[model samples]
Target: MKRILTTFALCSAMIAGSASLPLHAADAVSNTSAEKVLPLNQRMAKKSPEWLSRGIMYQINPRAYTPEGTLKAAEAKLKDLADLGMTIVYLCPVFVADDDMNREFWSPRQKKSQMDSPLNPYRMKDFYHVDPEYGTDADLKSYVDTAHKLGLRVMLDMVYLHCGPTAVLIDKNPNFVKRNKDGKIITGPWKYPLLNFESPELREYLFQNMEQWVRDYGVDGFRMDVADGVPLDFWEAARVRLEKLNPEIGLLAEGTRKENQLKAFDLSYGWPFSGPVRKVFVGGASAKSIRDSKEGFRKARPIGGDRIIHFIDNHDISNDDYENRTEERYGEKGVNAALAMMFTLDGTPMLYCGQEICDKNRHSIFGSKFGCTINWANAGSEEAKRRQELLRSLIETRNSRPELTFGELIWLDNSAESDVVTYLRKLDGKQTLVLVNCRAKPVSVDVTLPDGVKRHFDLKDYEFVIE
Candidate 1:
């Protein structure tokens, strides 16, 4: 879920600054530029599917999702996800990883070993086949089918920006790759070959590959990786071509581009909000910082700010984060509060795999090692069951209460003190109000409601209420 193009900026602003958020929280824009607006027809070609708009997205790293590490095993858990009330299941790239570490590569982990690791799902070796390590081609199809049967849409994550060193495309079609002035291959980090967008045939090849996933595997859409590296024109053209095959197919981008970027896709990641929320609940920032940052995002994209997917924990932040995972940083109780706000606040919320169980083991971003896989035992444990119930109830409210999902946001004036922040959401003649306490100690706050109920109340730290 974390397809970070500017990891340094995110690491500095989120992980390091988690202890104390800077005053200007929304200034952290990645690969930012003045956007040239597109024509009205292209800008509003499609609205995000209603199911997706109201749904809470869940990111699944199939490799480490369970002990079996196969799609069949993942298929078995479809009912569990359905019970959690998740509407979307986004699986990381099922494509083969470069098993041949014969070529040179360097990981951000600072390790100098020349060994093969299947941890990085962003690198692809073959687009046609599902990773044998994960499962056979049939296994993936079955997984997607099961998701659909359980009333969940599946988004297959695609790594289209670059390919692994031993990627089949490197030698199979040299014309499809980016090359330097001297004619040698242009290499990104880890010596992976960058794709040449200028090649029409290459673009066509990718478009068809995308179609195969939807047509053959029965996936609903794709969660594109490093979308910023690919030209905007290419994406718009690709969307036009692919939608013919399935108009309902949604396109989700990982980068944090502005209005022009949103024109080509249905959704984008709200990564900028990550650190500020942590700053409020776990770090020392005030509750007002959350409102300030969200307001900044709203100003930037007045048309479709809610399309950005928001989350407390995702694959990148949970697995290979520069700082500790959300569980460790926020602790168990703090996680509940952070997630509660994520579900009730702006945009479509997301939950990373294993979060329901409060999974604590951190896997290497490069690959999973001993003792790092998700603990299935927690799935039936009391703590995990409690979280499942909490998440289910939150999602139930989000769906049952239209104001919670599609309402206009209005911060309650002076309704909260330093430790608490309250806001009201209104839509379709209904209103929903939320109050969250980020403090660790119980405190009383004077607050007024729309129904003329005004009172002071005490709340435990990281507690919240929706009315």
Candidate 2:
């Protein structure tokens, strides 16, 4: 029997007026009348910074971003990213990684890198120092400074749940790490020692490290890795202290916990929607699956202010293998359709380093031993230039139109729900219609809006239109 997941209506009633309500009153309204409930769009705008809503995020794996694989080299590309319409540049971990070449155990992915001395970026040896492989403290400061000058916000990937066995924290205070009944340190999925959040000393040390990034490096925000592994209270406390330094500091949780947004984070990963999205294009899933997954997420996380970060590719996905890349699995045209849905949907969208040019090379983070550096040479190719233009235009459209950013997403019923997805983004009396063909063939869809106006679309393979 095919299990049916509870899904939201495809043609739900349009969200009505609640525009003037203050963001601070979200809690009070929830306790009051249903009619006074704040809409999702307004709540998001109220909770997050205006620039965040209008901006697109670009994830840069420093190891693969440039041939040099150093902070100095990556700094040179800030203007190019800004020119490409990216307002946020999220860098993967650059902290001093464990270089214990004699370590017996290695994860499968690490083994794939085939490095004699693997330096997985996630395995941190010291929280305060930059990995010599990437650059020095001064280089990091310059990178952040350069990004700010180019009108881009830099967010550092923080691996807080676990650290390399020889981390300074463990050496300073062995009790800072969690241990089993036998008094052996507990190892996480990546074979790194897990930090004991219960230790107040450990908590204080990690909190201070975060403050250093903001104060010394002038980082605009942090993307917390394996955030769910840590206690929510810890994140809440960290946010309080960090906000005292920079009120506009953003927190993006790598976990799907909805409550992360209530206070600790500005956005959570849209893991549920990502799978169905990929299936629609590559696995021949119904277009309705996309709608179903999104509605499922909304139902599970009913908070109006909650937001998600949507992406088709990121460091983890790309490093897994070349065949897993969106461009590799579905080709450029299919990637275009996926990108359209990602950017147009009611959430913040993210792009991996080479996604704008549709680069299909795998970017391994363990090391460059497997020849995993991004192929910048591909950027000069004609096909890459065309895809770049498409991405740039999509970002420009999203940034210029406020409705697309915080708009109420109202799914419209269409004749070809199996292959076509239709919706409207309505905000402040303005509405933008979006039609997407999820399949790689011609789709004829007849969509009817809430106002009873019907429109016909002859969408070519994986094509999308926004008007």
Candidate 3:
């Protein structure tokens, strides 16, 4: 929920100015520079094919996915997902929860209409077994197989920072938990108990159990939750073991920090970009500030490293929106523009489960969370269909264009009155200029291009090439 990066060092000059604040770059060069060229072979060697390089990830909330809310039913929609052009599918949690049993176990309100059974699936009841409500272990395998059949890789949400006090593992293996100064084991967050990664037995058990998920289910990787809470040593060890199992497997960290970027993870959340991007779109934050912050992160990356995962909405954002935001803030057009920003820029972009259909309802699942279902009836609506179609086109374009997939990025400077952000990505001998107008008024500005060849990419119709 919180950001992990605190360092404020200027690392690169490729960051352009936006509305947030004017970022000055003394040595900034034009988009057509020799250093701005990336080779496809080199990028493949450095980034690997399994890291969702140029791929799109779609987030699925199992509980809220359907009225039935079972793995079987969820799996039935794999075709619908793949049809949307999502290559990577990420499900929140599959393991049974300690709290999902009673019909009203999770909902505090107790109102039948507002209440769904209690199930914080992420709070593990048993790492080795799947929750019956969600489905059986074999069902999980089926889901994985089905996803692979559709050409989609699955990333399970790993919540290892802590577990429910009543977790079966707690009673079966007391050593799996963190201990206080008294040498007594603690359990649950309410009890301030956490997994003691320092203990040899605990460490071995956690690592093996996690590795088992990959081995048994044929899962691609883990989207580690609260990754910052865990130490680097644990991650380094897990990375080593997991890599041994499948080197091409992907690892996504929820926490994004410079210290965690030491090759242990394939990609991490792009908070540095997400935070500023949200502010700029809502008019609370300036595009200039967002660009400067992103520049700071890019400056820190080594020559060849894992790309960052960029997005405007996720479980975190949706949950937070329940508290202080509204669907109006991210209306249909606004959300689409945000998607365009994520897709055109560097790194893999994530689409939250119901984003395509425009689920405006903001409710948390922590309590009697609405368990808001995707409006399937609206699936055929013009707005929903259009968004999905646009997403498909962008994804297809990204997959086809080597330059967009692994190209070097150079942000172009527009005038102070400009509300549009322009940048270029280049690889091989090909190059593309992406200009996104974030304003209501029509923008008329001269954009410099490589070899003085300016091409305009219209976000409205998904068009490119300068006039």
Candidate 4:
């Protein structure tokens, strides 16, 4: 229980800067973080690059983003994403996808086999090679280089838990995979075989490959899928090794386990917290529920909560099903309300591709039998243009003002209505009053502000107002 740069501390160092003591420095207190929470600035006088705290990441599936569905094609949109206030561009799996397992899946025209399901990007065929469909290794380098030029960091999608049914490891080193009682390889729900992390050789293999992505492609971060499935010891050991190679590179875990944030990962998705935010708009949820949820999450954090990745829709959640789409599930206004909550909360925000334009289609990177690519033409349409501007404004509010990203919440009285939630984000002498009406219909409630503070109160259905 001595001073140590645990994963939590590393994440804080990337956000709160040198002012933050190493996470384990509080040896006298419980490791669960018994210390009293302080205001954003007071908690740490220094701050990391503004991008880490105010970061807004836009996720793109290279194979589903542009009609060409290649890294080169997606590179053309980097500047646009940057303009949208995205400091990080996360590409969903650029490595070679398992073609052997997808022989039955057809290509765009029903002319050839696509060889894989969009739901299974984790089934990698090669740890080092870029997918033929996603262009050559040079294309990935160019993509990362373009993002860097735009002042953007590139986060690669990594899947270490498993490989494709026909991965080379399955043949060359079958011992690296898990075997069932029947001596058959154990597979996940998607039929993808699982890797055996107990094997030191396998761990080294994955570690070296992840290192290659950072060193070779200059990737700034890695979004590991199903991180909890891997042994915590391995993640911790690998993190120590990887960070020594490049201290600035970051690691993001797709899992929700809070303990994962305490040690091995720099960031983890706030999957549990996201449910309450989305439910608040779906009706039946009260303002108290949202307040309680946010407060609890803030208090429960073992380190800087800013490391949490908040998002309304992601590649995995933004499925092809209508019920899962941002437009159909939450609608434009609901999506905006969610954004208001997500950005104003203590976390790094993320925007899925087409989310800025209120894109209706869910991302289906690879066709099971037919093609379903994003229509690039939407970026030019009138509705898309409006949404783009709206999205830009929402993110700018978070990035331009330190209070929004680092502020402590001062919940305001909203007893007048259950459908409405109001609060103030105050820090560094700046304050932003956020009022959100979670109902499907407009609510006109008379609101009283603190002395010398002023804001508009009239709210439309599912409208989020920041003043």
Candidate 5:
């Protein structure tokens, strides 16, 4: 049976005339000739000049980023990455893997039991320390320092769902891990041993570790992994605790589930919407399917005033599962359009490590050590060059338009026959109309802008412009 989920949209509708918060007008610049964009949303009104609500984000897999394979090397590329319009840099997994080489590599005996990789950034071997392979403690400090110097906020990949077999939680405090009926620890791939959040000791340890990261490293925030597995109460508690460390410390959840919304997560992965949208845009599914999935996501997810991370593909798809097949289906042209849609929509966009160059090398965390590296050689290709530039432009466009970031989305199905997906983002007093053609040919249709919109600005260069 198909499952239907209820969202805050319905809940708010039920309360109708009753107001929860006031909708304030945006200070979006009325001057069309202005060269630079302004951050005028309600959320950013009180923030510092460096405060960021909408901008580009870059994802770097340290191991694959450079031959040196160290945080220092990743730091060297900050300038290049910043040039691409990155306001944030998300490092996948920087913590040390299992110390023992034999224990680190996944073997036949451990395959079924492991839920993640020995190198999985989600499984922490040491909370207070940095992985020697990635870099020393000082090296990590430099990475964060350089990122901030470059005007980019750094977010660490916080994997709290589980820990490694020989981690402090498992060896020192056996009570920290979840156990089965027979008192045996429940195991999964990647050797993930679940944390016992019910225990105060375990909860305190996790919270303290989080607090240390904020106070010591000056890390901007956390990109929590497997957020769904953790207890909601634990997160709500963490949210309160984390704010004490740094009120500006952002919270981003890796999972896309309904229950995550009511708690402390500031941003959620729009996976349900992204997957179906990509499939439909890539010709794997029908336009009707895309529309239905988007409608479902809108109805189910309580995303108003909160950020949702939108993407065409991340490491899970770009590096592993969907790698080999994506190029054949979408080709260079199709992927560019897909990136445009992902970045321009009403969400914070996420770019997987290799997506900038159409890295279709089938990234593998379990494959050959050197094979895991990004094929920098592919950057010379025309297709790769085009995609890279297209992504940069899209991100730059997003940075220039605050309305696209915090605005409300109004999807327009102008010509389903032509496979065109269009939408208008309205925030404060600014509005942007984005039209993305998913089909092979150019699709055109007359679009009516909101009253007085055409008189103030021009949007014709864009697919569905007002003036």
Candidate 6:
């Protein structure tokens, strides 16, 4: 006779207290055991590091950060970022890139580079070494060391899903590469050869490389690229190993999977919220869309301790379409309002390298070939000075106010929902009210507080206030 397993039998076997109970009784006992396992949100909140909750992330595209485009040159500006209240410095991929530019399948962005042999940082040739164009391994070490001294954490952008055709792994471990049924290597979104995560040897190799960064460079964390493409189990296993090295190390996933927040990642991108924000401010959509999106995100991910990394602009958006830049499309006041929402909202805020100066130029990952370097000369201008002061104030406020970082968010309905957004954040008996005008015209709104106190606000074009 074949053996059979039933739900009641399994429950009875697993729970000692349910072993002697009836079938229905055992089912109830199993349900009780299930309740003991905390919800995903509470589990995430309990396990996430304190530093991650209060961090202000700043992205640095080394190739476009300075005229020299070297890590050593970029190191000189660390103090400036620290002064601006930035807690984390995220560096884009600096590893050696494949030099075979003659490949026909190069992406459109890659072909725009002016150099005869354009070195796209995303195409990794060697994970172990830093690209000489950006300086040596010693330079990277010094950069991390200096950041640590300034009380700033460092996160490297990890591209583990795919690699250049001529990557070192191809010659050393060919079986590590993913292939189709026809025996040809599989390509990913960037037209690069994908890695086979099913191979334990390959997984171990990548894990070792991750450890090398922590062991040798003392990196605080990693911002995973195309994280959704990789298996969730791999990230879960990687997090377990990484935690043994540094308990505080953070893992930021670029994708938006809710499960990523359960175990594999500390934070994920806030695309759901950002898209509606762009629609409202840039596409002339109703401001109410912003509120709807936020509520939708909350409903979709009911277990809410998951954190999102919010940004007005990042490398991919800025590079893909120069015209879509926040500053270029929305102008100075619009940029300020958008940033205010990002800083005062529920998620952790991030700033791209040149965003503070109202940089109108695109800072491409491919350096000046496809885009321009930050005009440091603009720092001395009156306009740049004003932007810097405003950003500094915002950052300081966010860092000092625990209420803004760990508060409960409540959206307040207002008369001007079409052109304005109003919300409240409460924590530990402290309440903060945030009002933002999303349109280019003045807006007046009547907002009634939970205490039944009514107040009126008149805001100028694209203005934001935190009370």
Residue runs of model 1 more than 4 Å from their true location after superposition: 1-46, 110-119, 189-191, 260-262, 321-324, 415-418, 446-455
Clashes within 3 Å, all models in order: 2, 0, 13, 1, 13, 0
- Selected candidate, larger lDDT, 2 vs 4: 2
The parts of candidate 3 lying over 4 Å away from their true place are: 1-51, 100-118, 183-192, 323-327, 367-371, 448-467
Q: Which regions of candidate 6 deviate over 4 angstroms?
A: 1-46, 112-118
Best-fitting candidate, scored by lDDT: 2
Best by TM-score: 2
Q: Give one digit per residue, the lDDT tens place, for model 1 in 1-467.
A: 11101000011011101111111112222322432254322222236656666878998987568877779989999998897788899988878877665445434442421114633557778888888888899999999888989999999888788887678877778877888888887877656678988988888889889889888888888888888888888788877777788877778888756553344677777675676777776676766677666665555452443356778777777665533567777766677776767776656788989889988776444555655578778778887877777787778778887766666666664445456767666776777766677666665676765555675656665666666
TM-score of each: 0.85, 0.90, 0.81, 0.81, 0.79, 0.89
Arrange candidates by TM-score, descending: 2, 6, 1, 4, 3, 5
TM-score of 5: 0.79
* lDDT (tens digit, per residue) of candidate 5 on 1-467: 11111110000000001111111122221323332143222122112112435646677777666667789888988887777777888887777665433454343433432333445555567776888888898898888889889898888888777777678667768889889888888655555667788889999998998888788888888878878888778887897798888887777777756545444666666675567766665544654454455555444333232346766666556544524645555666666666666665655677777667777655543322535667778888987777677666566566666666666666554433235555566777776765555555444543333442322211121122210
lDDT of 6 by residue, 29-48 (tens): 11144543855333322245
What is each predicted model's overall lDDT from 0 to 1? 0.68, 0.76, 0.63, 0.65, 0.60, 0.74
Pitting candidate 3 against candidate 5, the one with the higher TM-score is 3
Clashing pairs in 1: 119-366, 119-367
Model 3, position 150, has a per-residue lDDT of: 95
> Which prediction has more favorable lDDT, 1 or 5?
1
RMSD of each: 7.8, 6.4, 9.0, 8.6, 10.0, 12.4
Winner of 1 and 6 under TM-score: 6
Worst 10 residues of 6 by lDDT: 9-18
Q: Would you give me the overall lDDT of model 3?
A: 0.63
Question: CA shift at 103, candidate 6, in angstroms?
Answer: 2.8
Rank list by lDDT: 2, 6, 1, 4, 3, 5
